[model samples]
Target: MPSHHTPYAINVRGLTKSFGGRRAVDALSFTVRPGRITGFLGPNGAGKTTTLRMLLGLVRPTSGAALIGEHRYEDLPAPARTVGALLEADGFHPGRTGRDHLRTYAPALGADDRRVDEVLAQVGLDEDAARRTVRGYSLGMRQRLGIAAALLPDPPVLICDEPTNGLDPEGIRWLRGLLRERADRGHTVLVSSHLLAEMQQIVDSVVIIDKGRVVYDGDVAAVGEPTVRVRALDGARLAAALTAAGAVVEDAGDGVLRVRAAGAEQIARTALREQIVVTELVGEEHSLEELFFSLTEPGAGQAPATIQETAQ
Candidate 1:
């Protein structure tokens, strides 16, 4: 569905932003729905940060607009009450304890102390650490604190940029689990990250931007065609069988071949006709890392990648 008419959790229409006479976001438009984790993905300079800044009302847009429900972020009387953001630049005070920092934002959003402790625990931060100064908190702990602050208001929508930065493998896994849990609870989660390998398993949908334009936006799995690996004795004989069956097979050399334009069943049927014994038949799951490269690479261009945007 079009972001213009859809009632997604987050909506942007013709959202454009500029920096130093360069278009960071150009006529960008998309929607993020509740109960799903939408990935905000792009390369290092792919306008992900600028677009997010505009959505959170941190950076004024050069043109266009974004809205959280019917209200613009800046126009909302209490932003944190409706939308929680965890941008890379946003964090707690170094001198203040993790618990105290949340307390400061709580009353501002009319949140109670009891709710504060609950959210801290929800994000896996120890409430006992409330007395400890933030200066001693590790990068992972600080991230947990940021998530706690975002959850404190019990907002329906969340916007987080590079939340797993500076985190170890374990911490990254923990953060992914937390985000998935929030989405499962009907919270709309928007996460932007350059690391596609890490984000793939969690995000339900994705909106990928490139060179100030949306390259592909769709179900992460549906972005690429299924890949298959084939192995057999007498590679040439097998390829000939596939070709005779109206399939395209390219000889990749070294007894290896790349099969396209045909599926496993067809290839198997053809191989049986030629009396070729197949050694292995496997389907390749296109990983997020591979998909990202194919979508953004030079020769691949914009044609092969398909963008599917729908609202629930």
Candidate 2:
């Protein structure tokens, strides 16, 4: 088991990376705090991978800085002991057995065979599976091997890019538990993925990007407020009343109104005061997927206000 230690925070400030005339990451800025899972999300073409590479010192940024705590990746005294990353699951020699693959990195990380065996079991890779060559492993198995490698050092910070890509539901659930356990033990975790639904269940905070820039950054719960769905015979009157009462009301057609900034009780009170007939009323909270689409979809206009800004 990894010992508890103060985790290092990840910080990116105006981090930009460009290829030819195109920018992959544009002035990206966000912080991944210690002891929490921060999801780095975006659409297919968003700069998530590039930004992560820059943070790991694998890719040079066109400008700006990506740091681990107060030092850059290259400046870390013992890189493996400070940060363990699983950027690519397929980064393995085809002929190498899973155990050998881990052994190759273990020496450099000051880990022994026992540590290697521990991590292999930690990732659910049994001794039999560990003895198999990478060429014969399934995608999910490969992913587990990669995770085992990352865990070999028991680093304070973990960065996994789409770590759940090839995992089954059970595997995903196991991975979530492992990550949550790490965070609970004071390890910083940064995960980048398009699986919003799964990430919503795993991450405490989210940093959503679009077109190489941050669209939203803060607590996952703060992505959107809970909304009330109401249907009234006097739709127009109710909408007018709700709007006047400081609610943002949207027409859901068929005399139904989707409302925010007001609770069901308040809506009922307003309808009663106006003597309107109510047909249906339900409270709904926007899912992470819905929030992601709203921010990254075309014609999204300006990004919604962040939690920090809303508090001000």
Candidate 3:
């Protein structure tokens, strides 16, 4: 994780919340720094949404408080000027043109129409898109429009919940670059996504929550323990040889074996001792899905991506 500096863009202290007798957020506290992208990951029932709402003063925390920069969101001199959020991209008026939606918000932010054009162009929504009603726009277009709205005032901090929702692969790529650019401009960004495989390509760090509490909070790459997966003939004999060689080897699903204690070279040497012919020798790269499951309850699989149509 990047070293933290004081005067955080977002801070929560002893935050807690409940819904229908169940606690959704429990004494959660963290700081989000400017010029960084902190990813929020959690299971469906995790209190991520509730926590975000409380952070923005949209929902009163059952206990504790949060601040946007030095001021609580309600205490901000100008809420839109201090911070902008895209909790749900579809919250805008579907019948309104993209330009009109931004125009409605621009004046209230003490910003002019020039800022609107600048942001719209920055998000790659051209003048033609400005004239088209959002209802007629594709999901990619809507996502860009939402981002444009968040950038309307060029707030120092941004919060987005699954901003990549309904976007094509190229759209996802564009959004990643846009967020990175915002961070480079000294803007703080807190992003939430359930899709784990793609997050490493974008986020700087991660804070994972499960069952309404923090499970891990650190660099995204440091969450999981490394393991090596190997395949070879006479697998049983190879496993025995690995054990004798002081390596941790166990049966993995299918015909594969997982060895954690020793490196690939060691595993290969041990396999050769048992007259085994090695076929595949590979080290594991942690997946967001695997790390999520490890943090949460065991055996709870990832929600399969049914949104592959949008991936094109």
Candidate 4:
């Protein structure tokens, strides 16, 4: 395993980008703490790719700053040693073998061929697979190879964009565990993906954006308030009872109801008092996907500039 003496968090302040008179990113700001996984989410044309490009120094910010470890990415003494990124899996030379592709960057990073081979195995691509040309690899295989390239230099910071696009269930699981373990060992990871359910399972914090602006930034758990979902024998009666008891109830159909401003106890009491049989009751916070929609959907409420500061 590789180690670094200094591991820095990502900080973007008032970042903005414009292309041909259209703003791609508008004053976006967020902080990714060290030793944690942060999920970056946005709908299409939300400027996610543009923002990431600015962060990686592939595209200059129209204004403001994007810094890693208090320094611009271009200012890093050895960028490969400071940060590793997997923006896309299609950057490979089709005719080059997977092993050869990885070897291409070894000299620049000062890594040996042995390290290239090591990373190949780390990403679950055996020597046989490595010997084959990248053009012959599946989408999933290409994704793995991209990850291997990112891990090759063992940088302290990892930024991945939609890394699970072509991964199978098992591949996704493996990638999730790999990222989790890296963060557990004090590495910083910022991942952008549309897989909200999987991200909810792993990310410690999240930054959500829409219309090229941040809609939410805080701990993943704080994204949505808690609500109790209930089901009863008489749906109409339960809905009326819950509403009469000062609880906000939504008819979710199929005899299920979504109740807010009431706990299980209050709900139970209301049901018992109404003589309505309770079939099921579950308390849960807003799922990441639901919150994502609420934040990005048209006419949705905009998140405040400062959401919340969670303890890392």
Q: Using TM-score as the measure, which candidate wins?
A: 2
Candidate 1: the clashing residue pairs are: none
lDDT of each prediction vs. the true structure? 0.77, 0.89, 0.79, 0.87
Query: Candidate 1, 67: how far from true, in Å?
Result: 1.8
Provide the clash count, candidate 1.
0
Model 2 RMSD vs true structure = 3.9
- C-alpha TM-scores of all predictions: 0.78, 0.85, 0.75, 0.81
Ranking, TM-score, top scorer first: 2, 4, 1, 3
Decide which is better by lDDT, 1 or 4: 4
Q: Across residues 1-312, which tens digit of lDDT does each residue of candidate 2 receive?
A: 445385799999999999999999999888999889999999998989899888888999999999999888999998778899999998799999999999998988988999999999999999799999999999999999999998998999999999997999999999999999989888999999989999999999999899998888889875556888999998999999989999878887777788888999999999999999999999997778987888888998455447676433
Cα lDDT tens digits for candidate 1, 37-87 = 999888888888888888888899888888887678988766767788888
Predicted candidate 4 versus true structure: per-residue lDDT over 238-265, tens digit per residue: 8888788887777776877888778999
Name the candidate that leads on lDDT.
2
Model 2 spans > 4 angstroms off: 1-4, 229-263, 266-282, 302-304, 309-312
The TM-score measured for candidate 2 stands at 0.85
- Looking at model 1, residue 219 earns an lDDT score of 82
**Tens-digit per-residue lDDT, 155-259, candidate 3:** 778899999998888888988998998788778899988888777778887777876677766666543446788888777888888888777777885879888
